[model samples]
Target: MYRAHSTVATPSWFSIIAALVAVMLWSAAPLLAALAHTSSPLQLTALTLLAGALATLPLSRSVPMARLSKGWQASVWLGIPLLIFGAVSSYFVGMRLAPAAEAALITYTWPVVFVLLSQWSRLRTLRLSGVIGALIAFSGAALLLLPQALNDGLGGAANGYALALLAACCWALYSWLGQTAPVALTPLLPRLLLVACAIAAAASLLVEGSPKALSSEALLAGIALGLGPYGIAMVAWDKALRLGQASIVGSLAYGVPILAAALLVVAGMSVLDWRLPCAAILVVVGCCSAGRRDG
Candidate 1:
């Protein structure tokens, strides 16, 4: 009995903890960018991906470059499109319509998609508690994002919200693909993927006529976003997933939004009225309690 329990609990706990740390760091990306006063979210995302991809170079020994497959070559190359559409486009377009909190709520809905995919794939069964938890989380999300929905003129905000949610769906696809694909490419894959993404982004900037519009500050912020949050946080996320199952990791990923919110409050970017705290608490409870029935 001791052995049985230990085997299961240990991996779950470890994955959860690792994911918690990863998300916390990952959550800081936007706040730091906001604090840095970045001019363009698209450019920042490009730089972030570039930095993240570059960081993997030194860690090449962990995922040796030689072991990668021909198919993986395509997969590695394909990440450019994902980064551009998912990270760059989503960041710029989503931020325009939705504030960070609203965008994050929609984006983080990947967990629900994850859950549904797991059930559909027969990877795992979903519990009623998890479903209820999702609804509760959604409720908190609505409160967090739609406070002025009626009066604020949903025009672009609604579009942004939809785009962000779509981006989250893309993220779910990314996660799902990971389960099937072994992390066979070296650490270089991520960095290389970023380079690919950068190329794509460069093409985008040229086409969009953003070069003249790009300021020195925006460039720096882009580098920071690429290197710090995009690059470093991804390493953290990779470590977390390397430790164990997706479910536990996804659960712990909930910590990101909370941390982001706290940072927003500290920066005075958002209000900490009674509803905010209450909503945050409810979100925490719902997410943390989703699986506690078995615990």
Candidate 2:
């Protein structure tokens, strides 16, 4: 997705700083999500989306997100919101069964999925080398679930990782479609988030038996999650991608999961072990390999 260097300016210090800040905020998201003990993922998704909508109101005004050259306006009202609602809800749901680190690594598969989807659809041909690299990255995911699958059946134990994969795919599809965006999206963020919130809220009402009230701790964490990762991190990432060498800025994103995993380990929410680091290394290497000469 960061392959479009022509759209970005030369690297700058501010751009790098913005990228790092995105990394930090995003890395803290799961920690906050774990703390946000809602009755269901749908409720959490709605809350975070509502908070994100409020937080990005000023951003929507400051950023230029209208049609730059007008061909097709983005689906700020429907498709985009549906995708985001799916991604966020799935991620929140998946975080329950998997360790924070493992789930974090799983979502990072977005890069790999993004590369492959573009290659398959836009380019209409995927290189054998890229396919092999993608397989290797998928192997890392297998490493993550093998132990649990051994104890339970793959059907039950693999649910979390499967949902995580679904989340990654939804986000990947969103990114792929955005490559030809007729309008900028930065300014429409609030509306986008609000629409997503409505979807989540409706989903919660139907499936989860209505949205329950949040606890004080959950409320605070949800606010922080929205204002930081879902809100500011998104804005910062946009600026960084546009202002810096996109490749360099994107490389920094690979570290977000690692840092998030470390945070979980330090917090005693999870443990750092051979599985996570090795799996992460494989994922990054495979994704980088797949990116090379594929897009």
Candidate 3:
């Protein structure tokens, strides 16, 4: 049975660094979306995946291919690849279709999803605080969607919000499934990413044909996303989670929406909407509450 506990021996400094890395990785989504304005979402996704795979290639060299291949079987290669492809594709498409801030807000709902799923599976007992927090968090999510719901309805930004939620669900499912995988994730990640890259490439070719010429800025942004958020950041995040208190690291995840929204505003991609701050506060508080340890 799963039991909740914190690693008291883990240094605070390392946890802080890991938390910072996670914040950066989370914020990278909207930034990547902003940078992808000139390119097809599919193509951009493909390029970023390819770049991530290439960046991580050296790290995977020492990992035995046979062992890695065995891990793929554990993940049920078909399901894992499909999940990653769906998650990335939906996220990119949602970003393309809606405001970066809104998309980021929607995608950041995965923590709530995780909590709910764990409670549902009896992996963790839901405390009163968790229930209340889930309600507050979901309320914030609803508030974020209100603008689109009122204005364009399902025909416009609603579609993007829906897609973002879909992306969140896919991510949550993948995370849950990863827990039961036969092989540990650290060694499995590089290979999993390679499969994701292949899926993205195939999808891009089918939808967008050959990759077209991109502006210097877009190219740089894509490269940054590949190497930073999708590549090195992932490795750091995994290490941090493994070494740090899960609750503390999970609480830090709530920072993503705020960071992403602020960055988008600074980039002039989004206005400082009143709803954003209010929703962010609620979401962060809710997530923190949900992650609290039961006495």
The numbered model that scores best in lDDT is 2
Instruction: Summarize candidate 3's per-residue lDDT along 135-173 as a digit string, tens digits.
Output: 887788888787767877756677888898898888877
lDDT of 2 by residue, 127-192 (tens): 876787788888888788787777776664367778888988988877776664655666777988
> Whole-model lDDT for model 2 versus the true structure?
0.78
In candidate 2 the C-alpha lDDT for residue 273 amounts to 87
* Cα-based lDDT for every prediction: 0.59, 0.78, 0.72
| lDDT (Cα, tens digit) per residue for candidate 1, span 177-269 | 555455643355465556656675675687655643556766666666666565565665566566665455645666666776777778776
RMSD of each: 5.5, 3.0, 3.7
> 57, model 1: CA deviation in Å?
2.2
Q: What TM-score, computed on C-alpha atoms, does each candidate reach?
A: 0.75, 0.89, 0.86
After superposition, candidate 3 runs with Cα above 4 Å error: 1-8, 58-76, 123-128, 151-154, 293-295
For candidate 2, give the lDDT of residue 257: 64
Q: Compare candidates 1 and 2 on lDDT and give the better one.
A: 2
User: Which residue segments of model 1 deviate by more than 4 Å?
Assistant: 1-21, 36-38, 61-76, 79-84, 123-127, 182-188, 199-203, 213-216, 240-252, 282-295
Better of 1 and 3 by lDDT: 3
Query: Which 10 residues in a row give candidate 3 its minimum summed lDDT?
Result: 1-10
